[model samples]
Target: MVERRRFSRIIYQAPATIRQGGTVVEANIQDLSLHGLLLSTDGNNAELNCDILADIEFTLPSSDIVISLVANLIGIQKNIIHASIDHIDIESIAHIKRLVELNVGNDDLLHRELEHLSDLGEHLSDMGEQL
Candidate 1:
């Protein structure tokens, strides 16, 4: 498996059934990534480059902030909706990471990056490991 630079701070997922113009469809998100997400919607039946997309809102369990994101359906598997984020930014990534650290505490998950923070000095002092 490839090492992920960012991880999902998933709170929950619900069935996303949307309609635009005159068409109706339903789909689900299997997993979410930092830049994009894995959708399992009825996208396989779509043409090579379909633009049928929608905007969705979801809340983060930590901050309870409902972030609305525009997404595009990319692939499909057995009626599952597979989609990706239309646009993502580094600021959003950092916000999610900070929320995770705040809610989950600064244990293994937070300390995983200690090796990279060695130059920060403070974390080095906390770890009781002298440089």
Candidate 2:
């Protein structure tokens, strides 16, 4: 497969719950990037173009993280759901970026990604403060 993604992706399996309004579905994330994730479910038929709210849980070297983000359903190939992050917090985004840095194994690329994290734009919310 050709790598057409702007940011590099890494295989990451994590437990996740995807919710759209009252409907909820469980899935395991197969691949991840700072921008989005590809998840797989048994027989979920999530609608395309709908906004999905997800809580993805994973463990890193030190701490366990639960990343809560809102994403739009971009595509679905059989059981795979390709969702793009539409909203997240700064801390969560930074942690995800750090995880990617750990997997990417390139010092210069990590440094550059650190710089790019600040430019992820206004989609990041202050919802953490409310919680």
Candidate 3:
């Protein structure tokens, strides 16, 4: 029963730094999507609605292009923070997308297709329960 609209989540562990104002805090990126990212940090100081800047360093699988993206933190839950890339950060995502398109095999497509099938099944199940 995943509540998120984006069901296709690729888990990746990478070092991240969240800079709020002048203070910088270290964290880890647990999951990623085109929309937002899940961050695991130590302290609970990352508030629900606090916006912070994140410097993420991660390597694309099988590629030597280790990229760092500066993103904006959008929300927090428990010790995990969620962030969405601002408009200016689209280029970075675009670069990643291109890399995935070039390198990824049929597995990525299969997973995305399975996610849609699961959503359909869930919708039908909900309708059955309602009836």
Candidate 4:
């Protein structure tokens, strides 16, 4: 298989809450990237659906700032949940960017990832307009 990942993932472990409709599940973030995250949940897999969007809330490590975003539950394998961020507030994105920057350690790579994310967002917006 070819590597198709556009963003660098940082190994960040943190407790997170995923809320979809009336169901709320506690999960641990296994890794984080600009566009998505890998989460590990206990036995609450039955409560989540891949077709539904979920609100994920977690605080930055050792900080009081909470990062919240709406994500699409893309896939699940055993206890691991794969989530793709669909919508995030400006503040939350900023926090995530900083976190990635600190962990990635390469300014050029981070810039490239940011540009890719911007381009993807523009492309999606244009697609929406065409519809």
Candidate 5:
């Protein structure tokens, strides 16, 4: 298959909790990117569903700063879950950007990805306005 990812993914493991409605499940982040994350749980969380919105909270490794964001559960395969970020606060986004920047090791590439993300957001906002 062709790769369509616009953001660079970095392998960073961290414990995360996903909360949807009244259900909460613990998962380990397998990898992270600016736009999405891959999580691994012991088993498929039957309570979570694809296309549902959820809140994911996790702290940076060796740091007390908590990064929390709203994401959409887009896919699940056995023990792995895929979530696409839908909304994130300023502080969390800043932390995430710095984490990604450190891992990517290329400031220009990281800036390009940020630009793409910003463009996508603007396009989505325009679509929302039209609708």
Candidate 6:
């Protein structure tokens, strides 16, 4: 398959909860990137283009990271629900980026991406140096 995303995606699964209004669904993150995340869930199909708030929590090999954000439901295939991040705070963004960098296991790629996000004023600490 041809890669078309504007941002690099890290294949990582973490437990999550999706909430829209008063409805809540348990889910798991199938993949994640700076712009979005794919959620796997068994709940009823969400309305297309609907916005939902979610809390994703997971422990890394070394640390735990939790992210809270509003996202737009973009697509659904089988059990996978794709959502584009509609809102995320800077601190959560940094933690999301760090989680990707750590799980991706690539120093050079993480370095370059950090430099790019940094240029855009969304800088996260480099895990490259620590590795």
Considering every candidate listed, which one attains the maximal lDDT? 4
Q: Which pairs of residues have clashing backbones in candidate 3?
A: none
Worst 10 residues of 5 by lDDT: 43-52
Q: State candidate 2's TM-score.
A: 0.74
Q: Provide the RMSD of all predictions against the true structure, rounded to 1 decimal.
A: 10.7, 5.5, 8.9, 0.8, 1.0, 8.1
Q: Rank the candidates by TM-score, best first.
A: 4, 5, 2, 6, 3, 1
Deviation in angstroms for 53 in model 4? 0.7
Q: Rate the local accuracy (lDDT) of all candidates.
A: 0.51, 0.72, 0.62, 0.95, 0.93, 0.70
Model 5 clash count equals 0
The residue pairs that clash in candidate 2, if any, are none
- Winner on lDDT (2 vs 6): 2
Ranking by lDDT: 4, 5, 2, 6, 3, 1
Off by over 4 Å in 5: none
What is the per-residue lDDT of model 3 for residues 1-131, given as tens digits with 9 covering 90 to 100? 95855434466667666666566667787876554578888884443336446555566566675656766767776788877654324556666555434444556774674566457658878998999
Model 1, position 105, has a per-residue lDDT of: 63
User: How far is 37's C-alpha from truth in model 2 (Å)?
Assistant: 0.4
Ten residues in sequence with the least summed lDDT for candidate 3: 96-105
Off by over 4 Å in 1: 1-28, 40-49, 88-131
Better of 4 and 5 by TM-score: 4
| Ten-residue region with minimum lDDT total, candidate 1 | 112-121
Which of the numbered candidates is closest to the native, going by highest TM-score?
4
- Give every collision pair in model 1: 39-81, 39-82, 39-83, 40-80, 40-81, 40-82, 41-80, 41-81, 41-82
TM-score of each: 0.43, 0.74, 0.55, 0.97, 0.96, 0.67
- Candidate 4 error regions (>4 Å): none
